[model samples]
Every structure is written in structure tokens, then in C-alpha cells.
Target: MKPSLQLKLSQHLALTPQLQQSIRLLQLSTLELEQELEKYLQENPLLERMEEEYAPPLPGTNDTDSDTAEASVNETDTATSSADDESWLGDEEDSNYQSASSSGSFDDDDGDYQDVQVATTSLREHLTAQLGLMSIPDRDRTLVQCLIEALDDDGYLTQSLEDLAETLPAELEIEPEELQIALNHLQCFEPTGVGARNVAECLALQLETQPADDTQALALNIVRNNLDLLANRDFVKLKKLIECDDEQLRLAQSLIRSLNPRPGSKYAALDARYITPDVVVRKLRGQWTVNVNSDAFPRLRINSLYAQILSKQRGSGLAGQLQEARWLIKNVQQRFDTILRVAQSIVDRQRQFFDHGEVAMRPLVLREIADLLGLHESTISRVTTQKYMATPRGIFELKYFFGSHVATETGGACSATAIRALLKQLIGSEEQKRPLSDS
Candidate 1:
């Protein structure tokens, strides 16, 4: 093709390195953000955490000023005062401070070691411990371990015997029948249903371990054949199919319900995460108000002494570092500012939820908040993803307030959250003798 000269005008977006970092930090959870901050502290010499004593006091206050200002503000603005009481970048001196601290020597030459205890165990480890006590041949033990590895987190053996057999080492020359025997032995292990192929089989394994009785027999039969009817709560059909009366059916169901569907879960280690809410909501003078949680954002600042020293030395590469440090501090402040704004908007729209509970939650969308705040929908999503708000009702994720709209009878729309609340209420008040049917 011949060279052609043409001018085209178009607009597109570009994300700079700092902008990309800010966006990534905005979307991170509280734990992840803390980790990111630690990484920055290690890499950037100019960045340092602001200690409580070293932090600057609030505006219009002096070191010699009595508690008069604080007392007066508390008295006049009881509702809004507490919400806006603390500085976002100030170290917490109050008893309600939730941050943890450690006091210990970092010297490795002291020859002191602390033994930390694990609070949870995994399913595989638990099963393997039990396997160690079994009096089986090494070959059989190896086969059982193979089967144990195949069990899912829920303790269900999702793969078939034929499929599992293919996974064995070629030298083992194990058949499907041998694998089935190994699985049978594994199913007999503790937790009751570690090797069951399906929900029915899992329940059956538990029932087999129980003492033989009428209820046990009936439960086994129901689990084996009429599990669908039982699951549907079709007491009438279940009675006909299992040849049992209402009382007997209820007893059988009680037995079945007592069985653990997910036996492996109890042994699974919990990956628990503690959240510090980004904002706090409280009723201030009969009006809901939002306050940014001081603990959620770390107290960060550019070391003034270091900056001054670096400024004295020209062409030392420290100027650029100083600028970067300032940019980071500013970006961190802006991140929380955006979070606070988004949280405030959510609190304003979800006031009813604060007043009455989740049942009063209205329909909301990211677009609505984005439009109101003059931000992009993706930015709103990032702000709301890992952010949380603590209210009088309870702590909830910001995204919890946004739901798909459902049409109401009056041609308006109801939030799926509100509909779920209504459904839960209906189900809770449903009659025991006659459960409500889906209409």
C-alpha cells in the first residue's frame, strides 16, 4: 500500500504507573492494603509511619489548651461529634482503638524462640493421622492414601472408580474393583463420609454406622430412594413412597438431618479475615451520618526532617524520591477521600436499612452512585468491593447495598435484597403442618 497522510482525532484513556498503583490499592482489602503499605515502607526510604505523639494535633488547638474545646464540641454536636471525632491520620489514644501492637526484642543473638500453636487442621492431615493407626499392608495403605487425596473439600469423592483408576501410577496395575475396595475402606474412616461418591451415598455411609433400628432403617431407605421427595419437603409423596406415617416420616427426616453432609468441612482450616470498616454510621440528631474510620487508613506522612536534608543536596536523586513520597501520601489521602464519599452516598441511599434493617433496603446500582458522584462505574465498583461500613444494625460490605431491581405490583421495582427479606419472613412464619407452596 502507498504511504497515505491522514489526520484522525480520537479520545482514549491512559493509566500512568502511579495511577495504576492507586487503583490497585483502592481495590485491595484491608489486609492486602496493609501488606502493600509495608512493602512501600521497605522500598521507599522517605516513607515513615506517623507515631501518635509525633502526629500534628487538630486545627485550632494548641498543646496547652485544656479539654474545653473537646468538651464543648462533644456537648454541642453529640451526634455528629463522635462520628467526626478522631483524625484519620492520628494515632488512636482511646480505649476503643482496635489496632494491635507488639513489644519484643528483635535481636537474634538472644537465642529466644516463641512457639506458636496452630488453631485449626486440614482434612487431608486429619485423615492421614487416622490412617497411620490402621493395621493394613503398605500397598493397601498407599491405595487408601490415593483415595483420600481424591476426596474433595466437602469429603465427597467426585470422580468415578474408573476415572480414579486411570490416575494411579502405571506400575501399580490397580483395577477399578481394587480402587472401589480401597474407597470402601476409606469411607469407614472417621468423619463418617469422607469417601462417598454423592450426597445420597454420604448419608447412607453415616446411617450404616448408626445402631440398627426402625428410624435408622427408614432413614437409610429414604436416603437411598426417596431423597428427592425428602429434599422437596413433599411429606405427602414421601409417606406414599416410603410406606410410612407422618410421625414416622418426621422421625426419619430428623435422623437424616442430623447426619453431616459435609464431614470434611469441620476439619478444614478456616481462612478467617477480620475487617476494619472504612466508615461508621450513627444516628446524629435523628439523622444518619457517615464518618471515616481512623483505624482503616494508616497514619502515613513524608518525614519532614529527611525531606529537608534531601532538599539541601541537589542532583542527588533524592528530589525525585521526595516528590514520589509526596505523591504517595497525597494518593493515599485521595483514596480514603473517595472511599468516604462513596460510603456517604451509600449511607444516604440506604438510610431505611439503617432504620428498619435489611428488609427496608431499596434497589440500588453502581451506575446510580457513579452518576451522583461524577465517577466511573468501575471506580465505584473498586471503591465498594472490599470496603465496609459499620452501622447501628450491623457491619456490611458496601456492595451489599447494591442489588438487581425486581418489578413490584405497582410497576415500580423492588431490590432483590428486600425481596429476600420478605421471603425469609414468609418462610419463618410458615405453618408447620402445611408448608406454603411456590405460587
Candidate 2:
């Protein structure tokens, strides 16, 4: 142990602070990166966020652009207030706007945003609104309203009329026939298929409103009895059973396709997810291009007003903070640059997917991209994970482009995505009698 000084050689791995910061920034999502920058801005006196600048619309733009410019001017006009008034962000108004723009109303004045109120209505409410317009007797109206309440979100009264009659108070002496008559009235509501107990009746109710032609009669009979034949797309069986020709069967099929299977789903309050894409891709002049979304990351700069004072006053003990600020700025730039390179490489390899669709996607792996970019597989994973790319098709994550390979019949390989796409196409087009199996 005492002779340890004797010549010995060894190697040890170490990560510099700058390298650690770069890796951390690379792995962060757009929202996480924005939050991280906000934290740094608050802590570092030398760092500040630059204000966003919106330029005027170019001349000779489309009418849509002109409308948007006018709307922007209107927004500015409506939002502006005198200096003595409350600031735009601090509006104390209790007015309520709608969560959706077209649903409800509220005033947006003095340049301040108002809290929006949720204005969703359930199936029951929608039916009740129409029921209020009826001039039926109070007794009949009550029974119809009860049936309306029984209807589910898809506009189907799930319970049978017999079950509904028995569920009513025995002292009221209600009968299943009365409930049936009330249901008939409910079925004739604005949504033609509402209040039906089953899919067959739902479709039949809708077909009842169409022109009373031979085609409508055939369609009505098929929905009420041979609905399964239609679902299986058995046109030959339908033609044989209904004693109809090919054109009549085709017309009936088209009529069936136009029916709403879930009539009340339009009123369902669907939750929407928002995503901020890190990169945007577009085909420019017959060439695919990848560019960083500048708005995805906050613009940061060194505070010249503060840095100037620090420079003149020597030994202010802020040199470490100043160095840290510079490191953050450089690391942020490197993050976007790495993301752009990786995204561009992915788009180049999957260009077929952009032109055609998922079926044309080629097999890809992280190792292949890492080797091409001369970086580690871990770095590629970091660049792909949680980072999204906006393309003409839709917004997709960077990792969505890479997948495992599936062996093909030509002694080659296909991407799993392409295989799945092909399987889906086959399944959709497969004949009912001879459907695809695991084999």
C-alpha cells in the first residue's frame, strides 16, 4: 500500500457540468423545457426572456389572412384600456363565456380574458328542450319525459317498455302499452333514431321518414329483420331473400350506410388533448424539409441592462451565475440543433410514409440512426422521447417513425407499422364468409 506511487495506469469516466446540463436539456419535453427556462430566469439575474414580436400581414394575402388581421385589430381594440383602469391580465369581471366559441356568449372588453363556462348539455336536456314544444296533455308529457330520461347518451332507451312500466309506482297504474305509445312519440323527435331500444329499430325509425318508395320498403325490411345480413355485407343473400335486383339491393345498402348508429354522440363532451410540437415538417418545392418550431421554446437572452452594470463593478460575486446563464443559453441552442438533425434524418428515411401513408413506411431502428448521425443510441432515444414533430398528415412523436422489422415473403423485411397497416386494409376488405384467421 505504501508503494502505491509506483507507475500505474487507469481510466475513469467523468461527466462535466456542461455535459450534464446538455443531456438534461435534451431529454426535456417542450413544456418541461419552458418551465426549466422560467426557473432559471427567476434565479439568474443576468438572464431574461425576450418579448415576442408579431409582424404585420404581407400584401396581397388571401381573404382569410385579411380576416385574421382584422380580428387581431379587433382584439387589440377590445382589449385596450386607459392607464387608470385595471390591467388586461387583472380583469375583475365575473362574466362567463362558453368553453366553445360558438356555444354561448360573453363580453370580451378592456383587453382582458374572461373565464369560460362549460355549456355542455346531456341527452336528457336535448330531448326535454324538444318536448317543451309539444302541445300534448300533461299526463302524456310526463310519461314521454320519463322515457326521455331513460334514454342513454347514444339516444337508445336501453330498458324495455314492460320493464319501464313495472318500474313506475304501482299506485299510478301505468301499463306497458302506455309506455310504448310514449316511446313512439319520443322516437319521432328531431334525432330520428332516438328512443329506440335496439339498433334494428333505431335504423328502422330513421328509414321511416324517407320517401315511401320500393327502395325504402326494401331497406326498411332489411333493417328490421335481415340486419345481420347487411352487417356481413351479404348482398347476394339479401337479393335472393328479398326477391330484388342488384340495383335495388345497392340502393338499400347505401340507405343503410347513411343511418346514424350513435345519434347522441354529437352531444357528448369529448376531452381534447393539446400538444406543442418541437419541430415542423413540410414538403417545400417537392422536397421535404424539417425546421425547429421557434415558438416551442422560450427565447432567452443575457440582460444587457444588468450585465453592463456587472461588467463595470468588478468582483460583484456574480461571475458563477453569469457563466451558468451562458451555459444554459448554449445548451438550449444545442438541444434544438440536435432535435432538428435527428428529426430531419427520420423524415428522410420515412419519406415514403409522408407521400403515401403508413403502408409505405420502411423498417427503422435507433442503432441505424445513431450510426448514421455518429451519436450513441441513448442520445437518439433522448431526442425522440416526448419530443413531437408536426407534419402535413398529423402531429406525431419522433419515436413513432422507428419500429421493429417483420420478415416479408420476398425474403426481405417490412416495418411493423407497415405490416399493421396492411393487416388493417385486408381486414376491412375481407369477405364475411372467408375472413382472415391467425394462420
Candidate 3:
């Protein structure tokens, strides 16, 4: 065996530190981006947020002379920063600040933000409060409280009496029969079906409390024995089994439908998620336009005084920090630019959906946008993940516009979302006596 060395010329992609940071900032959601900016502002002495009064004019100035001068100064600064190892300070002078404001304006009439307080009660708390008021003996009350704690969020007692009995303390010396009795008493609590073991049992428990009548008795019998038939909506079979006419069966069904399946859910704690959209879309003149939400982003800039002081010093670490701060500013601008471009492309492609509704939404894929905007599919995915747009209809996540394609009768394709919308409309307007089938 022999080893030989030869020179070969090839190229492979490598991401620089600044480039990696740019990519990371590009994909962060609005809330995450704000937090990242805050961290940088605290850690980096060169970076500071621009006040409202000091905000510079927007980018892309129409002044040709100013643009040329700015370009020359930038080039000179770049060369000096690269070549001078002893001192970053140079004889050349240039404007110290760059504009950080985005291209569009926000509506000043949107009103002030207010904090809202929400009051909520959990299912367990509601049950315990009711249990505390019972006049029963302390021992039986203890057993009932055990069963109450065992009930799930949906008010269904999923654990069997045997299982619960085995888990009881040996000192209590409780039996399965006593636990069953406690469960029965617990079932009698308000929100009628709290301790039921299953759907049939829950419905039967509610039905038993209804006033005695022929219809009530028949409904109870159907729920207790033929709950499966009722769920399948086999009216002909149900009519035969229950010995009732169409009118009576319909009335019974209406009664059954009025019963609550999840009685304890009303008492569950409220989990409200607040969404702040990254883009606001509206009709301008005769065409639709997009604007990045200024309120969601912090206005950041380099400190001019620090930069001036650092320029006069020789061989200081502040130069690297200054470069990092500039990179951060440029990266932030690029992030918003990419987002705005992507948002415009979406609005253009989904004009029909905006004009009509979800039924008019077209079939879209990440590749389509990626190819249109010269971006990677993974980049498109990241951009759409947690970003949202506010439209005239409602606010929707960017991912909501892209869906699988379904073939139509005319050999054209429809989005699965549109198909779902159509199906929902059909079901909603269907006649109860003759419901529409899949065909």
C-alpha cells in the first residue's frame, strides 16, 4: 500500500458566525424576537433602542447624492476596519446612524392596550365546594370525597370500584360496595352526570331526573339499552325498537341532544392564548397592501456617542462589539424584509380567499413560495410556523393557507381546507329527516 498527496479544487458551503446568527433571527416568532433583542440590548454596550423623537427617516431614500456619499463612506469604513489592526479609527468620517424604521406606517387610531382580568374555577374545586356543604356523616363524606377526586375532567369516573377500593388506606378498611355507594351519592350532585362511568351511564343518570312521562320513559330505555343505535343515527331501526312514530322519535332525540355530555367542562380553568399578528393587511385604493406591525418590534440602533469614542481609541475590543452591533441591525432589517416579501406573496396568491372565504382558498405548498421567492423550503416552513397575518375576515396563522390538494370533478384541484369548508356547509344546512351522504 502507498499514500500519495494531490491538490484538488472544490467548494463546500460554510456558515460564518454572523451568518448563523442571521439565520437564527430570521426564524424567531414575534415574541421570541423581542426577547432576543432585549438580551442583546442588555449584554452589548454598542446597541441601544432609538427613542421616538430620534427615529430616522425610512430606508431607500430617493436622494442620489446622499446615497452615493453613504455608499463611499461605507466602503471606506469596511476597508479601514479590515486592514487596520492597531487602530480602527480612521481619517474618514461618515454618518454614525442608519435608519431602523420599516417601510410602512401603523394606524394610530387602533386605541390603547388594556389589561383584562379573567376569573376561573376548576372542576375539582367546584366538586369539593359542593361536597363540603353536604349534611352526611364525616366517614361517608370522606368516602364520597375520595370518589369526587377520582372523577376526570369530563366528569366521568374512569376508575372501577375494585381499583379504587384497593388503593384505599388499610386503616380506613373500606370495601368496594361502600365505594360504589359513595359514587352513587356523588352522582346525585349538581351538573347531573358528574360521576357516570360512560356515555350511556351519564345519559341515563340525567334521564332519570326528568319528569315521569311516556316519552321520558322511552328515552331512558333507549339510552340505557340501545345507545349504540342512537349514536349511529339509525332512525328506522330505532323506530322499530322503540315502537314510536317519526314525530315522537324526533321529539325524543331533541330531548336527548339537549343533555350535557361534558357537564364539568364549564368549571375548568380558562386557558386563553393572546395572538399579536406580525403583518396587517388591508385594501388600499383598489389593491391590497401589507404592513409589518411596528408595535410588535422594538426600534434598535447603534449608540453614536459610543461609536465616536471607540473610533478615537486604538487596539480596543470595542471594535468587534461595534461590528456585532451593526450586524445585528442589518440582520433585523433583513428579517423583516423577508417576512414582508413572503407575506406579500401569500396575499397575492390568496386574493380569492380574502375576497370570499375559506371555500375560495387555493391549494398552496411551501415549495411554491420557496421557488417564487428564491428561498429554501425549510426557510419557508420556519417563517410560517408561528407567524400570523391579520386579514379583513379574521386573523390566521401563515401555515393555515397551505394544505393538501384534492381532485375536483373537472380535473382541477381543490385544497383540503376548501373541501372541509364545503362539507361543513353541507352538514349545517342538511335536513334532519334526510341527511346528505358522502356521495
Candidate 4:
């Protein structure tokens, strides 16, 4: 074949970094946004709070002189107003953002450390707790720790016993029999599927622990040899191989679906990071109103004290400090402006969904919104990724509004989300004995 170059016009999805960030921000829960905000504040120090309220002076003066004085006072007030004031352009609440300072810290007095606990004990911890129950010598316990560390998030051992044993010194040799005993003990932990060598073993461990029956036996057999058939429901061949009829095969299929595929994952893969809902939409008088969560966001003001010091200082120090201060203020303002624009766009696109239900979700793609806002798709994606809005329907990720378009049979496009809503409704009304299989 000869190589030739030709230009063709077509559309394709390109995931840019800004688009990725928007998508990520759109999906972030309330807790995550706070954490991000905290990080920004730590890096930038020009942002400070205006704690003192403004009070007007007494009204009394000669006409021309008083007017000039009043005008000057008004300009000063405009320049140094609180964040709650209209002139203040920074985000509604910068302090609400999660930061190391906001998060709990070590108490030297109590000799204790405290941090926001994002997740409960992981799968490894659960396995180690089980090890505590067994009467193992310190050497074997150390080996067990190494083995536990080798297990993947799914609780399958990715390392061989020899590999784990080799990590220890030459004198502290681990026998296969002792290693086998430790492995056996580790397999019996809660969540049923921990410490298996592979997926087949994982399923088998669960099956062995469950109530015994022919269905269980056949399902185990299916897991062992004919696991590939599980994907497309090729039960005819499965029936032939397992020597079971149609009804028996159906029962086995049902049993297998109910099994936990990632047994260790339940304990291990809970959200490592939490999110903070950015925009809160509450229904009032049958209409939705959007507000930023401001519980912890205190008003920020240019520190008059710092500004006075800068003004008095004569050297290069003042110039550097002034530059730093201006940058800090500008960044904070930019962060808020971006957040507000993104939040408003979300409200505009998802208005119908918020008012009605999931069925009313629009066919909004990140590219469409990014084009409208004159921003890179990746930027929009990051902004939307982990951000959320609380609607009358329920709290939803901002990214939830932007779904891939599915062509309709008649003419116009439909959102993939709308189809999923239909599917969910159909399934809810379906009979258990005969499922509503996809066409």
C-alpha cells in the first residue's frame, strides 16, 4: 500500500487539561473544594480579612470644604470596604477552603495529633487486625506484614511467597509451610474476599464461606473455568460445561452477579479525599436560588496594619511587599470570578433538570460551555470536575449536567443521562423472574 495524505473534516473528542480540570471540579464534592481553597490560601498571603465594620462620620460642615472632605472619605471607603461590601470583588468565602491550618493539627500539650479522617481503616488494617487474633511469633508477624503490603487494593496477592520471603535477611529464612499458614489465616478476614491469589480464588473464598448449595457449587465451577462466559451471558455453553439445564444456569448467573467482585475494595477504595459543594441551590417559593456556601469564609480585607508598614518603609522591602500584596489580592479576585462564572453557567444549563428531574437533564458537553466562556476545554473540565450544586431534585455533580449526546430515532439528539433515567425506570418496574434486558 502506498501512503497518501488527505484532509478530511470530522469531529472527535479531545480531552485537554483545562477540560479535564473542569470535569474534575464539576464532580468534586463539597469537602474537596474546601481542601483546594485551603491549598491556594497557604501559597498566597496577600488575602486577609476585614473584621471591623465601617461607620460613617457625623453630618455637619460648611458647603464646599465639607463636600471635598466627604468625597475623599467616600473614595477611601470604596478602596478599603469589607468583602461583604459590593466593591469587594474577591470570592464570597476564601477561609472556607480546606487548608492544613484549618484542618486539625497536633496538640503538643496532650501529645497527640489530630487530622480530618477522610476514610475508615483500609483493607490492610482489617487484615492486620485478624493477624492480631492469631498466635504468631514476631518473625511470622513481620512476614505477614510484608505479605499484606504486597496485596493489591482488590485484596489479591500480586507477589509470590518466595518474593515476600526474600525481603528478609538470609538468616531469617521463611519456610513455605509457615508462609502457607499465614496466608491461610489472612484469607479468612471480613469482607469475605480478602487475600486471594487471583480473581478465581477470590470468588472461591466467597463461595466457600456462603451457605452451601448446588447453585453455589455450579457458580464456583463457572468462576474456575468458564469465567469468560460471564461477561456476555453465554449460558448455553456454560450449561453444557457445568452439566446444568436452563433454570439451573439462570440461578447460577444470579448468584454470581450478587457476589462482590472487589471484596477488599469495599474497605480500601472509599474516597481518599472529600469534597465541598461549591454552589448551593435551594428551592424558595417554587423557584431555585443559588448561593455559595459561606459558613467558614470570613470577610477578607487589605490589612491596614500591613499597608501602613509598607507605606512607611523606604527600602526595597516595601517594593517587594507591595508587589506580593497586589498579586495576592488579584489571585483571590480571579479565583472568585472564575468560580462565579462557572457556577452561573451551571445554573443556566441545569435549570430544567433542577426544576423537573434527572429526565430533564440537557445534552451539555464541556466543549460547548468552554466555547461560550472563551476558556480552554480543560479549564472548564477542571472547574466542573468535583464541584456540585444542591438542587430541588437532589445534590448533583456539575459534570452531571454535561453528558454525551445520543441520537434520537426521530430527529434531535438526546442526552445519555436521559436514556439512563428511562432505563432505571424500566428496571424498577421490571419483574424479577424476567429482567428488562437491553435491546
* Top of the candidates by TM-score: 1
Write candidate 3's Cα lDDT for 58-121 as tens digits: 3322222121110011222222111122121122211221111122234422211111111245
The parts of candidate 4 lying over 4 Å away from their true place are 1-150, 157-199, 205-219, 226-275, 282-289, 296-298, 316-322, 429-439
TM-scores for candidates 1 onward, in order: 0.69, 0.52, 0.56, 0.55
lDDT digits (tens) for residues 226-320 of candidate 4: 87676546767767778988898888776766665556544543333333445556655775556554431223445576677767876635465
lDDT sort, best first: 2, 1, 3, 4
Q: Candidate 2: worst 10 consecutive residues by lDDT? A: 67-76
lDDT of 2 at 87: 25
Residue pairs of candidate 1 with colliding backbone atoms: none
By lDDT, who's the top model here? 2
Alpha-carbon lDDT, every model? 0.76, 0.77, 0.75, 0.62
Worst 10 residues of 3 by lDDT: 64-73
Q: List model 2 lDDT by residue over 1-439, tens digit each.
A: 4655567799997999999999999999886888889899999999987765632222222223121100011221232112112122122211221123344345554222322222366667878999999989887899999998787667878788899898999998999888887887898896778887777887788899999999899999998889877766677887889999988888887777666655665465555434678877878789888877655756677888878888998888887888999999889888988998999999999999999999999999999999999999999999999899888888888999999998978999999999999899999999999998977
Query: Which residue ranges in model 3 land beyond 4 Å of their true spot?
Result: 1-3, 56-272, 432-434
Q: Write the per-residue lDDT of candidate 1 for residues 213-269, one digit (tens) a residue.
A: 999999999989988777767788889888999888888887777676666654544
lDDT of 2: 0.77
